[model samples]
Target: MTHLPLAGRRVIELGTMVAAPFATHILSQLGAEVIKVEPPTGDTTRALVRGGPSGTFIAYNHGKKSLSIALDTPEGRDVFRRLVASADIVIHNLSPSATRKLQITADDLAAVNPRLIYCHIRGYAAGPQHDDLATNPVAEASTGVMDDHRIDGRPSRLGPSYHDQFAGAYGVIRILATLLQPAPTAEERRIEIGLYETGLHVAARDLAGVQLKMQLLGRPEKEGGGEFSMPGYGAYQVNDGRWLYLLVLTDAHWQKLATALGMPEADDPALAKLRERKKQRERVEAAVRAAVGKLGFDEAAERLRAAGVGFSEVLPLERVLAAPQARQPGKLRDLDYRGLHFEAPEFPGQAECSPGLPPPELGEHTVELLRGLGFDERACAALVEQRAVAVAREGDFAWAPVRPEASGKA
Candidate 1:
């Protein structure tokens, strides 16, 4: 295995929920020593599900150490300051007031370690619009992203927390870029990314298309006109009620699609040109929809494949997991964390593969980490006794297969 780019770096992740954890998860995969600091109650996601950590929590918190500390206590704050002083990067997604309350702001950490790269991920920019309680879905709705994804005038959120994930990815990129530059000054070390702005960044291509269409039509984008429309690239329902998405990017693709659907308009002079085909979008769409509707799922899939058309069945999660693309080595890997074996998604272009390290249970490494930080065993015990910190007393790692009886009956 190749050495990961961040092998020797230490990161303190003061994050909860998705965005910040997602960022640190990437860092952990890149071989960074990511220490996730959670409150004594543990991450909010851990309690979201009844029995244990939800899938969301596990997905974003894997390959990291957990330190459960009570930030409201002076001792806890002191411990965090010490950790930040010894860390290379400090990242968090707490609200503005939460940062002030906990005193873990970028400025606060920078005071202890001037060279530390402190990144703050939030749901909105530093302005009046930033709601302290805003979440991923709220941010998406506020950013017009949900409206853009409307189907028949009813706005719908994408299945996943798109903005939260995008913000995390952007945070990682910004952190990497900052690390590559000359030694950052105290002021230069702080970076802020808002979910709303990140949403706009992710929609650049679509926005560009909107802009071009507005320019061509000589209208303003916000004035209720100007949508960059495309034809022959959408989903059509078959006889069996399965949706088949098609991508006809070029004229040849359009021809192939038409032939695949057995549409008689293949040699029609009126639709020969790409512009003409686009102009007749409604007619073309109706024809394709009708053709696809006539065929069953199997026949439609076979004909589409035979025609070399870019298409796919709109598969559910189970089908997607079983697909060849999902089975690729780097795309997904079987993890044996403790004893629970499951497949986890792996990042592309990762140098050091994930070691399948399970996410630490709340405060699972508190004692060990405190000892590593030069605290004596007695001092660590005192902190735990004071309720300023919590440490797991059992084995460091354990996985119990959820028995059927655990659901309700013994």
Candidate 2:
């Protein structure tokens, strides 16, 4: 193992839910120190108890420290400013108005640290409709991604928070790109990524296909079949009811598949060329499906491997985790944190000496983090007493109802 790339970097994450935390998760895995700032009630995912912290929260918030503060209070805003002053990057997905009210905008932080990379992730990009309240699903629908993926005339959302996760990856790319600049004194960089834009970006391949079809045929058609519908490139159920997706895109692959399935008619004159094969798509699909469906899982896998066909079995989450590949060295580690044991993925080239940290309780690091910022013990205690900050202690609960903001506060 080698030292990770972001060993000394510091990141302050100020958003909840998936996107911002996901960006921090990637940073943490690369050895950056990520501090997550939360309100006194903690992130909403903290209360989603499914055996422990919700899987959604644990997946993104692990290895990050939590500091609970009330931004509506002047003291809390001062503390956040202090954190930004010494930070390398600050990321948040708060709404535009919320950012204005909290005074955590790019300009606000750049005044504190000129070299900081301030990144904002939102549901939509800036424009006349920039202030609309957007979520993961809404972003997907608005971008036409959902409609483009309609199944049986009904739009379907991708299983995961696809738009949010892609936006997070985009955030990481923007931050890293900013860090590559030569420094010694420079102005801050501001980047804004929208979930809707990310959704479109990720579907670039599909979008290109649609445009190409429209240009060539005067109208777009469904995917998975175009000028050539290679029957092998789809999911098929085996005799044992297991599903496997196969890929045989080239003529050579098709020949190999033909030989493996003992389907001599696949080489008939009418199906010799790709365009000809397209004309007989139903025949090809039916033939391939019948051949694959007759074989049991092991037999189908062996034949596919022998024929050099690219394929993968569809496995459930549990099976995916327990698969042989997951147990190999440098793949995963069984980590015990916060009274729970789970398999943690090992980032490529991460140092062998790296230690995993548990998700923090609400306010777990408030006092210590503030102390690191030059606050004395008395000041820390005073802030807690003033309801500007919260600190978790043994046998203590920091849970509190969020107060309605003052007329001018947010």
Candidate 3:
């Protein structure tokens, strides 16, 4: 097997929920050894589900070691400092006050290891709202993402935590870029990613369009941002009750779709142009709706496929796992948590490759990591006795299959 690019690197992750953990998750997939530094109680997502691991935790936290430490204690701080001294990167999503109180901020850790690349994912960049609390939805709302996705005239959140994931992806980009610098200075190694800024970036196209219209065209921004004004570019229900999203970006696509659906209006030369089609969007959409409404999902899909028209059935959350695309070889990796087997999608570009170790149970590697840090058996016991560090006990785990129906099957 070829050695992964980040094989020798070590990342100490102090993240909860999504952003920071997800960043390190990517690093792990790329072959970095990620040591997740959690509090004694473990990451908040661990307990979200009543039994077994929450999907959120399982999704972003696999392929890493967990070290449960109470940073409030001196012993725990000493352990973390020791870990950082030999670490290449340290990332966290803790609040400013929390980092300051725990003394794990970049400045503090850099004092221990100047070569450390420290990344902090926060709610905002350095500004008036730098210290304000922010979650995925909050960032979305603040950056106009929610406004752009509004429903019924009220701001609505995107179903997934897109801002958090995007910020995590950006974190990986920054870390990888910094790693390329030959002997970066301590100041240069420090990285900060703001979730709000990431949200703004996600909504940049709409924001730029609005500003450009106001500046150049002397026109007000549209009431509902991000809506597709083009006909045949939206979702329509078929006779089988399945929704299909049809896109007609080019005149060629429109021609193909019209021919495939047997629309009599295809002969109109005026509709050959995109601008002309937009002008008669209602009529075009009505034709599409009427044509689609007569066909079942399978027939419509077959016709669209035969005609080379771009379309996809909108799969609900429950059906996504069973979708043909998802079931393709190498699309997902098998995982077993306390005998509860399940599958998760492979990280991008990692298909058909090893996905490393499963997510460590809370403090699963505590004693092992401490021993590697040069702590003797007695010292390791002392830290555990003081409640400064925790080790995973058999009693702490339960075996409740999250998806029993899919268990023991390929």
Candidate 4:
């Protein structure tokens, strides 16, 4: 395996669940030393996924060490500061006020390490709607992303935890950029990446369609696709008990599709010539659906490809994981960390190695980390005896109760 791109980097994560932990996950996968600082219990994501093996937590916190410290104590906060002082970057997805409450504020961390890159993942950007104590669903609805999930144009919520993922990807980009600077651009840069902003950034290009309609119709639209977006961009059902995507956009592709459908000028030219077809997308959608139902997915795909059209069969996760792509040794690796195994994605020309340590079995590294921090054997033992920290054992229970309000849904 080749060396990871960000090897030798250090990151201190003060977030939980998703968002910032996800950013650190990618960093850790790329060979950065990520230390996840959690409260004595551990992160909430350990049980987030249904019937999954701490998969949600493992997916984000892989290849990182855990520091189970109850920062509720001044001693804990001071210990955290010392750790943050030694880190090259510090990140969290806690609310702004919660960040200040945790005492890992930008000034606090920078005071300990001036060059620290501080990044915070938020729900709303700023101002009146900023940080509404949101969970994944609340953040999705607040950002108008939930509305897109519904076909009827009604405002609904997202089906998954995308808001958190959004903030996670958002933070990862800024952290990578900050690390690549010739030198530190500023002493302490507080990058605020809101969940809403991430959604907006994603939809900006699509919003142009609505904006263009407003210009042509002399009235602004409240959403994308004001009766016409494009006929080739949606899902259609197939004949052989499956669904497929038919994308025939360009003139030539449309012509090919027309021939495949056995309809004269069914191409975009025919589409362009029809005053009704130009505005009636539902009619176009129905026609395309009817055309697809006449042939099996494979037959339709072949016909479309022959005509320079694009198509793909809807595949389940199990099918995807068993495909030739997944079988490629360079594409993925089934790794075992402390008895938990999962397939992790591998990058092209980049190596992903298991850590010197396992997933840390909750607080398995607590005493060892304390010892490395210059704590003597007796002191380390004392902290454990006092329940200030914990060590994972086969029969031991590490499940800790989380304060309900502190539950980070997003």
True-structure lDDT of candidate 1: 0.81
Better of 1 and 2 by TM-score: 2
Query: Residue 41 of model 2: what lDDT?
Result: 72
The C-alpha lDDT values of all candidates are 0.81, 0.79, 0.86, 0.70
Evaluate residue 284 in candidate 4 and report its C-alpha lDDT on the 0 to 100 scale. Answer: 70
| Per-prediction TM-score | 0.88, 0.89, 0.94, 0.85
lDDT, model 3, position 305? 98
Off by over 4 Å in 4: 49-53, 129-131, 151-154, 185-188, 222-228, 264-269, 272-276, 280-283, 337-340, 347-358, 395-410
Which order, best to worst by lDDT? 3, 1, 2, 4
User: TM-score ranking from best to worst?
Assistant: 3, 2, 1, 4
Worst 10 residues of 4 by lDDT: 347-356
Q: How good is model 2 by TM-score?
A: 0.89
Top-scoring candidate (lDDT): 3
Candidate 1 local lDDT, 1-410, one digit each (tens): 77788999999998888899999989988889999998887788875655456778878888889888899999998888888888999999999899989998777887898889999998787778765556777776876667777768888887788788889988999899899988766666788899878877776765776688688987635422122244667888999999998887778988898888899887787976678977897888788789899999999989989999999899987678888877766676566654667677888775335466687888988988888888898999899999889986554223334578796432
